[model samples]
Target: MTDATIKTAAMLAIGDELLSGRTKDKNIGHLAEVLTMAGIDLKQVRIVGDEEEAIVEALDALRERYDYVFTSGGIGPTHDDITADAVSKAFGVPCLHDPDAMGLLSEMYQRRDMEFTDARQRMARMPQGSRHIANPVSTAPGFVIGNVYVMAGVPQVFQAMLDTVVATLPAGTRILSRSLPCPFGEGDIGTLLGAVQKAHPETSIGSYPHFDGKRFSTELVVRGRDARALDAAAHDVAAMIEALTMEREGAKSKDLGTGELA
Candidate 1:
């Protein structure tokens, strides 16, 4: 793809457990990393409760706003799993049990000698005309409707579904990144870093600070789809760090010469 070709996506994290902190949501980070590597920029993330109204609202908004909208959670057999119904409502379609999905779940259950009860069969329900995204971890598949992908909330299952979905998506220009360790803190290079960022409009520069009991440091990270711009921004960031280091050394030397504390 061309350097200018960029795909943007949003994530909708569904479930009341996530909001209540009862079940820690572990799928967002993996999705973000996978999307980035696949050349899709994740621009927005929304976490909503298991309520159908909330899920439908989020799906509608995100699907219209981004090239792709991936939803995690609320796709299980439980009564609270309303993602399929919400997705059907969002697209003005009926949520029905797909025969293919039912067959797959049926075979899986039969092979394992487990009863494919009505509750388990709920996993086969999806929006009308949606395509299934095979879940390698769990036999119950996620589905894609319009621009939205409804996947399971379980970390392993979500990751597996993401692999299937990403493989089918058209890849754009992959964003590249570099990280530089800075001995100085933000106070030492804040203004200089800002100037560098302004100079490189195509690249994004960020400074994250860390402390280790006795000293504080910063890590300057540069990211961009254009390799040249990313490199240029990283170079400027390194120069800023070097300049600050030199100034600190020079000040310390001056203090030593004058017999004063630095």
Candidate 2:
């Protein structure tokens, strides 16, 4: 089952703590890695303070442009957890109690012999005509409204919800990636890497530089949906790095001679 091609998605991480740096985000990296493996390209990610209007605007924009929008944070039992309302307003629908969600919450609370207070019951609220996304970490469910998924900010709950969401999504053409490690600075081989990129326009080529205290190294990764294209680009990148390394080695050897040869 497929709808609209290209299979792209955007993620929204909602919280004032995120904007304030009080709570470090763990969901973005997790989502990016998971989505890539699932073959759904995660194209964009945004963080908004726990503001309803901000959530509405961001959700509207992303849901319109991408195949799906996965939002994290602001869906708990606190006053700032207004994601459900914001999502409902975004779709111009009423945020109402879901019977299935209600039953689940009610049963859980009853088992604990605790009153299902209004505040706790809010977790059962969802946008009208939406389906629930199960949360294994917490009983309160996340939900999907249109193409937007509203989830908890807590890493555990978010991860649990993500697994549930991924199962329902359609897999796309998987992106293949290969890395060529070069034991030299990126500047040493930037020119050759650029030429390799030009030669394989279909693939995405990136150079990541790293230092291991004693030396510098760069890892060049080539990514594309076509396996053959990916392999070709990787081969070109390897050859370029090899040639540059050899040239640098030759120059070093010549410098060491230091006028010994007339």
Candidate 3:
């Protein structure tokens, strides 16, 4: 990948059920991982209710602030699914049922021998002057209006639409990562980790704690685009863990079993 700085992306998850904890939003995590791999930086994520005003406000703010804005949810065949209309209003465009989308929806319904109701045809609505993002798994296609790409709420359909969109974005610097498990707990090495993070602000350091038998251990992950910088930070973190472990062993006058730090 090129060294060019990637354009940032922001996500808006629109649904009342998400905020109410009735539904867990899974699009954010999948989008983040897929966008990262495609060299697009996913910067901010927001969860908003199904209110049209809230959706419009969020769309306006995010579209202006980031290079791209992706919205998931509120696109289903239900009365509450008004994301397309809200986005159209946000861009001062008319929301109309696209003839092409309707054709696809009609074919899909006919294939299953299901009656197409107004609610099902509601999925054909697209924002004015927008391009469709095809969904391979399901019939309701996503649309890209300006910098905002609106997709479905269902996990499978959302992922398929994302695959279609990601291929068209510009490539950016790819991130690399390495991790080492510290036999000591996070509490024991939190200070040193903080210092290391301060020294290498470009790199991200994450500490995850786990139990090994009755003892607590932590896995330290170091990530960065620059290989040298990431390796240096990883070395420093490893040294810090080794020194801490040695100090603990010396104080207790006992040997801790070693599986070798990564």
Candidate 4:
């Protein structure tokens, strides 16, 4: 992978159900992982309701701020499905029945012996100058207009569309990472970890704490585009953990010798 400038992206998840907790979101995590692997930095994620105004405002802001904006949900057959309209308004483009989308959906419906009803026809609509994002799992397609990619809300379809969409995006410098299991908790290594992070400005060090049913431990993850810098930072983290462990053991030994509880 090339160590070029990092591409940036943002996600706009639309639907009232998400905000209301009626529907759990599975797309955000998948998108984040995919984007990170593709070298696109997923900088921000915004969840908006089915309201067109909210969608439009958020869409405009995200599209303007990021290199790419991905939107999910609201492009369905239901009356409340208004993502196409919101996208069109956001870009000042006309929302129309895309012939390519209509043809694809029509053929799929014909194959299933289902009528291409007006409700189903709603899936065929998209903003002008938008490109189709082929859906392998579902007949209905997603769309890309400008830097914004509008995809389905369903997990399977969203993932399928993402496969196609990610291939078309320019890959940046892939971030490399290493994880070291630390026997110490965050409180035990916070100060030293921060010092290591500051020393290695090229790498990002993160400590995630976990409980093993007995005590809290930490996992130190070092991430960077440069391999050497990442390794150096990870080594520092390991050394820090070792030193802390030794210090704690020595304190316990001293307390035991003095007949004090450690």
- State how far residue 220 of model 4 sits from its true place (Å): 1.3
User: How well does model 4 score by local distance difference test?
Assistant: 0.92
Query: What is the C-alpha lDDT profile of model 3 across 237-258, one tens digit per residue?
Result: 9889888978877966644465
TM-score of 1: 0.94
**Winner by lDDT between candidate 4 and candidate 1:** 4
- Candidate 2 wrongly placed segments (more than 4 Å): 1-4, 212-216, 257-262
For residues 138-230, write the lDDT of model 1, one tens digit per residue: 899999998998899999999989998999999877789999999987888899999999999999898999999867899989998889999
RMSD each, Å? 2.4, 3.5, 4.2, 2.4
Model 1 residue 254 distance off true place after TM-score fit, in angstroms: 3.5
Ten-residue stretch with the least lDDT total in model 1: 1-10
Q: Candidate 1: give its CA RMSD in angstroms.
A: 2.4
Best by lDDT: 4
Each prediction's TM-score versus the true structure: 0.94, 0.93, 0.89, 0.94
| Stretch of 10 with least lDDT, candidate 3 | 253-262
> Which parts of model 4 are misplaced by more than 4 Å?
1-4, 211-215, 257-262
The TM-score, computed over Cα atoms with residue i paired to residue i, of candidate 2 is 0.93
Question: Which wins on lDDT, candidate 1 or candidate 3?
Answer: 1
Q: What local lDDT does model 1 show for residue 117?
A: 97
Model 3 residue 177 CA deviation (Å) reads 1.5
Q: Model 4 — which ten-residue stretch has the worst lDDT?
A: 1-10
Q: lDDT of all the models against the reference?
A: 0.91, 0.89, 0.89, 0.92
lDDT per residue, candidate 4, 1-262, as tens digits? 2233778899999999999999999999999999989989998999999999999999989999889999999999999999999999999999999998999999999999999999999999999999999988888999999999999999999999999999998788888999999988888888889999999999988899999887889889999989999989988888888888899899888778577543
Instruction: Evaluate model 4: give its TM-score.
Output: 0.94
